[model samples]
Target chain A: MIKPELLVTPTSVENVEEVIDAGADAVMIGEERYGLRLAGEFDRTAVHEAVKLAHERGVKVYVAMNALFHNDTLPELPDYLAFLDKIGADAVVFGDPAVLMNAKQYAPKVELHWNTETTATNWYTANYWGRKGSARAVLARELNMDSVIEIKENAEVAIEVQVHGMTCMFQSKRTLVGNYMEFQGKDLGVEGRSKDRTLVLHDPERDVKYPIWEDWNGTHIMSPKDMCIIDELDELIDAEIDSFKIDGVLKDGAYIRDMTGLYRQAIDQYAAKPEEYIEEKEAWRDRALALQPDNRELDTGFFFKETVY
Target chain B: MRTEVKETAAADKRVITKKPELLAPAGNLEKLKIAVHYGADAVFIGGRDFGLRSNADNFSIQEMEEAVEFADRYGAEIYVTTNIFAHNENMEGLDVYLREIEAAGVRGIIVADPMIIETCKRVAPTLEVHLSTQQSLSNWQAVQFWKDEGLDRVVLAREVGMNEMLEMKRNVDIEIETFIHGAMCISYSGRCTLSNHMTARDSNRGGCCQSCRWDYFLYEDREDANAESGNALFAEEDAPFAMSPKDLNLVQSIPKLVDAGIDSLKVEGRMKSIHYVATVVSVYRKVIDAYCADPDNFTIDPEWLKELEKCANRPTAPAFFENTPGYEEQMFRNHKQKTPFDFSGLVLDYDADTGMVTLQQRNHFRPGDTVEFFGPEIERFSMTVGTIWDDEGNEIDAARHPLQVVTFKTDQPVYVHNMMRKEL
Candidate 1:
């Protein structure tokens, strides 16, 4: 059976049912994309609510706590993990080893997914997380298709790839703006417009002068790009991948509908006529391409191998 | 009464002591002029290449030269942005871009890439290199990491709250520049892939079509697709909040920002209008000067605060400063309508004795519309549609055309520099 997973931000819950209904096997929930921590803790109530609803429909729910763990906040992980366990999260996604270990220790029953934030580009990191008992891993966004195939071939655990979404401009969760705004006495996580705030430097080449009040988490590093892998599903599935994931928790339902529908059709076409599906694959590619975000260029995301450039 | 005044005076103590550099954004030459004229201590702009904002009206080489000269004439610093996340293809432009920017007498180059930093150091050794926020320098180790790489100043990440910044400052020696106002990103510093994954435009490479503004939903069962192929948006009750908060405004908290030991106070708009540049710069300039003039006697004028509200803004809140519980301050539905007032013209002459305010109209203004006068302070008062007299005292229901100088008598004194606006 072709099981498709959509990586969703909690903000994209509006389209979650639609994604699942469109034949997505599961949904991954993450923090708001803007980096503002609206809730003090992971909105467990929302998670439980989504889980109950999804389970009723035969879909699984995954919670993404994929941000880099601060050293100062490490002490709180056990409690947070325990809370995640208490909330009956089907699985947890994280970056830091400490957080992963803590989640494994405190919430042994809850499956853990290694987030791409850890930069798991090879089998070694994937194997390490698998050995540490991770059930799945959301591989790095930079990994090409070949690297994904290789990692899947060697990985001991399930492998997840970001089929779509913005790629972070930075290496990991290192943020000068987050630290700077905090230093200025502005709590970056607060949910309101404050007199004390952070500024995103758009056009950093120009003298920084414009004051953008929105997205105070620092300008978003990238925009959303739809992942159209409908044609590549057979190739990915042949690589022994555990899950085909869609990235974006804040995207619209129409995006969810069009993307999931095309993938579902491609998977069904591949299953029915393996050789004949090549032409169907081209059709799926066209369908995926048609869903592109505002006419942006498309790439296979190093899906073939490690990016050389 | 004396005791009450004393208490009020005591409450007005300075929040911060350091004189933070006011950094502004310049999309083009005109914005650069407005920023400098208003009060920017330094301005940052994108060059024609290697900057993230490819869409902005980036400066040409000659414009950069002119902008540097213009800023220098006013004693303001100019920083060129070379912060795009470069692949090999983009590296070729770095050497020439750096050399030319440095040659133009630019003060610094804000960058995020390590290779670019190395290139800038070799090509323009004298130019200061500030670490861009895209680098995401959250901890002291990372701060020192960039410093060791020869970063002269570091713009810290937005996800860090003030307490963490202080901790980082205690551990690092690098100059700290923090954003005091502007748009906030939904992703952590520059670590988002939401855009590039959905659109092939890599936001790090700087073409971002904000996908975050779109609405989202959480589906319970995948079958909602069969229910209604067209109507499928669903959201869980506790999902992340939609829409980014309006840009940060720290005008009233300038003293506290200075106290935070921030080396520079950066403003965030690049695609904004000239009026935005002038208004924001002048307000911050006045607030900064007021603090510097006499810390003991400084108080933000209520009138100045009202004037600040006239600029395009959502509801204002002091983000995270007081550590209040509730997200109300950051949540804005949307702007109600375009600002009700359109800037009409400036007052050319005013006579306090006759209470006559004379001006050239940028747009036709009808009688009975409330007019807002903006200068050192913003004052709004209603006007009755009395007989309007032209420059020659011709009675008319409205000032019919552009540049038509009209005179009206009002009780308040109108300054020559005052800008007038009429409600739409």
Candidate 2:
């Protein structure tokens, strides 16, 4: 069986190299103008360079063009896809059907990873996109372990699952933060809109703080807890899952490398000797906990817990 | 490159020259009839399973057949929503249900998941498959993608603007449906899982808890030392942070939309009252007709906005239609809507000779309360609540019980399903 590839969302081209060195099998990079909620973006030249750098080490690179495009931005997508194809991007992660359509027209060689964020919940939908030429389906983070296993068992395409990251709970096209600041008769400068500002929404009733930020796309409210599945990697590896994705969009370059390294080590150990990996999970959890941000908490997030109405 | 695709498509389909269908939501059979009576060209209903509005009183298969039969009488169409992003468990009995709705004469099925779409195409080939707005389709290529996949129509996302719709109409050959009036999702419709994370209710699978409307305090995530220092942004003294958006109202833009030849104009809210369905459907019906009948001299009526405001549960703005909504389009202090009008009663019967109209009381009403009566065909008229009579013909001063049969004298002739509202 093929070992599950570790996919890391890189914070920069240099970070892409750092993660590859730390044992990431693949890295995802994008430009802020096209991608949604990226940690950092690369220019056209940087993206070209990143692909070349990753390919040198036999690491694959996926470009994110997952924004919900309006007609105004859509005409430019074919050119963008052609550019990604020309630069030999291994795949293009997409949430909108238009991205797949444009890629089919202009970038047929580049693979398609259907990541609608929350809609790819079942195997039938995954296979449906697969038949339409998508090479992989990123199942929704809302699914539990049972659902994920079921999808992977029945899916015709490759499956990628989020193993560790901050999950986005809410995304809007309206500038909600800007709208609120304007309502309060205050000015929210560029600094206020930056994701590095450590903005969070506190639900006083629940006593939880959710990280919130605004970008060119709109407002994004993240979950209060990040997801860590180091201990759970065995079930996925045993299931022969195609890929494990680590979202470094909200973390630093060091966090990305360390998390990637820990997961890489665990995956290898679990794939090689399941009993030995099981004995080492407690220490793995502690190591992961130590790397978590001071204001953020970590949990297993919808993987073990069945979501109920 | 884009214009070349447009020219080739324009030569084949003159989609924009036709009259747009006015679609409305119906939670049950009663609301379905009310929507059709109020002049909806098409009505979308939900069955007992697979629809997003599970909390609503969705229809059974028998009720769906009856709804289709009833809608057909008025030359209107019935579309069923099987639009849930299906989990594996939800996939059971989906094929059977799609075939049943098709056999019951449903004109189409609005679907979000490809499982449902593929199932409908395989088992119920006669039914038109519409891609739901839950897919958040905002561009022509997405429309073209679904069109090639054998779907008939695509409901554009609430975030799409007028120019985008026009561009889609010019470029794509499939029918385009746009939301004109309704509560807008703060997040893109299907992309949000705030409810799933916050309350353990899956938003994509018909279990939305509306966590976006819940109260939350805003703050910056500073270090533990500074966390308690109150670095809250976008908050007044004690107001809860509100993410609930203003409802979409496109009454003023009816002429532009009709002129643009958009295929269907939809109103969102299956869980709303029959009175809301009647009022909103009728207002849009009138506006669309008035504009289409004489496009050169069409003007928006101020009374239409007043009628819509009477039933709206939130402040209304032209969200993503004329412009990108901003401060005036959101409610930041409180998420709740405040309106003075209460839907007081529904007309059951009208007798011209005795000057008596029977009403099933919906809200509390007593003698001397000023009330307004309106219906699908009835123009708005105000009257003072006079002497009331119970079903037993005994004299009564008030109709205190809910849905209790009450009779009142009205010199003006009223019809069935006419509604009565009183200002509070």
Candidate 3:
């Protein structure tokens, strides 16, 4: 069971079935109303349909409503949660304390999963949130496996770790694109190249490029490569991590299917013959590489970093 | 020690709003003292461990004790930051560190990690906890939630607009704190990982190399069939939007901030100089006092903006307080910082008998040069640099070298640490 319940990011309702069929045990959806990945979220009807499809296949559906909200907007949350409750969302993933507190009050029946953006970098936070009635917490992707194992050893709450994804290095509420384009004498998310998602960024001295995108809300400076830890499944299993999540909510169903299929095969192969996992590692890597999206490059992410400092 | 722990509830729904405390950043002990001297009601600082400002000359335990005593004399509060998003390795000494600072008479602790907040409840139960801007508490519910969790104050996110802050005051009865001045983070405070990825320096844990402020340019994606490896690499020279944001100056908005029931106005600079600490603190202090005294007749003193401009390293912008800052306000072309004002000297002890004030020159100055001596009490007083005595008590025409201690005859008395800036 520690091999991780393969989780897939199903951005739209139409992709839910593909994600499940591709062998994902769970589906994470970003609702259009809340959460960070607003560009890749499902509307009310879409999320309801997605949740229904996942549930029919015995796959869990987690709704991402992690957007930081103000008091004026918080009053409307209970109604949204009630809608999620009616649709039977397996869990509500969020990143704000108010969201956690409000979810407890309004939608107690819906399992609350605190996203890592809440700064759950240590065991204490997970256990603290567990005590506060949150069902699970996502471990910060910043933490390496050594730290992850240490957290899992002491934490009371069930924890999920991102095994593969487009890691966001920076996300801000300030719409830098919109504001910058206005300076360029253009509109934000409108007109020319300002709206284009391929606006790559480079470190002042470093020649390497990182992808950047801006929407109505804000900007995200993402990693140039997607994080792929298919080879590190053994380490996560050894750490007893609750789930392995693959992030790319804005990606299409084919992306979800390919990623989900690779992880599914990796998990199964490791399960059947644990000793052969290491020897077959490169073989599995090749299999995943064959299915890897042309736009994305893959690396181990923070899995091998050993230490944060 | 005065804690900011007002009960988050009152009979009238609004918490008994005191005049918002003028909080300043203290990179080190000198800066801490300068902040208090310049009319800061409370000062937030980082210790050598667990604080986010890795580059700053952070306080040691000995310095924390001294700083707490210094702040206490002026009836001001001291908040220590141990706000790192701790990994398993960083958590071991955290309780002991918290207890040590608490024993040092720190009035409060600013923390972003909830585990640290929970730890504070257990380890230093008497001390107040201020939720750092890193927590990104944008709404009143978030403020209320932290208050419910036993936090004394919530430093709301910079992205939070004026209306939201005001709404938080009306609904959320916590001590709401916001950055009224200083640097604006391009990413949500404490949420950035650009430094971590680019330099292996964790932004949350402190080694933020400030990758957001780095220069960058955009290029379109490569064509799928013959995708070149390096074509997306610098299709242009500079990004129109990706430059570091200008430093935030909210001194003009003090009246409106006060009207919105803010409990504290914080200036964000721990890695700043003592001169910067003094000038910024003094300006905000004056603005806060002026507004509180005559809220109805309040008008932004034009001189305050001029004073802020002199102190600032980057162009000043109002941030999201008025609205989302426009391109004109947020974006900058040249990323390098500029120092237009010369902080020439620090005011040393004054000798009434000889009518001479002892001073240490930070920058060079000439004999008979008019230098402005400004501090908490004295806003602006120009005095001619008369006969200057060197460190060995030799009279010289000019204080020719930086950091040279010189004594000069003065008609008006000057307080210690009063900045002497010769306009450059």
Best by DockQ: 2
Model 3 residue A191 lDDT score = 41
**In terms of TM-score, which candidate is strongest?**
2
- lDDT score of model 2? 0.86
Chain B TM-score of candidate 1 stands at: 0.78
lDDT of 3 by residue, A1-309 (tens): 456788778756767787788899988876545777542568888888887788888999888887767666677798888888878888998887777877777777899988855277888888888887788889877778887888889988887988887777777777665566666665543544332446665443665556666654477777767788888788788777888888864456687778888889888878888878878888877877776767667888877764343
Worst 10 residues of 1 chain B by lDDT: B1-10
Question: Alpha carbon lDDT of residue B40, candidate 3?
Answer: 92
Candidate 2: tens digits of C-alpha lDDT, residues B73-169? 9999999998889998888998888889989999999999999999999999999999998999888888888898989999988988998888888
Better of 1 and 2 by TM-score: 2
Kindly give the stretch of ten consecutive residues in candidate 1 chain A with the minimal lDDT sum: A203-212
Worst 10 residues of 3 chain B by lDDT: B1-10
- Cα shift from native, residue B7, model 1 (Å): 24
Clashes of each: 118, 0, 2
Query: What fraction of the true interface does each of the listed models get right, in terms of native contacts kept?
Result: 0.05, 0.86, 0.65
Candidate 1 per-residue lDDT over residues B224-297, each given as its tens digit: 22223332222223322234544567788786665556678888887765556666777887888787656667
Query: In terms of docking quality, how is candidate 3 classified?
Result: medium
Candidate 2 residue-wise lDDT, A194-285, digit = tens: 68887777887678888888887788988888899998888888788899999987789999999999999988888788899999999889
For each candidate, give its TM-score against the true structure.
Answer: 0.58, 0.96, 0.93
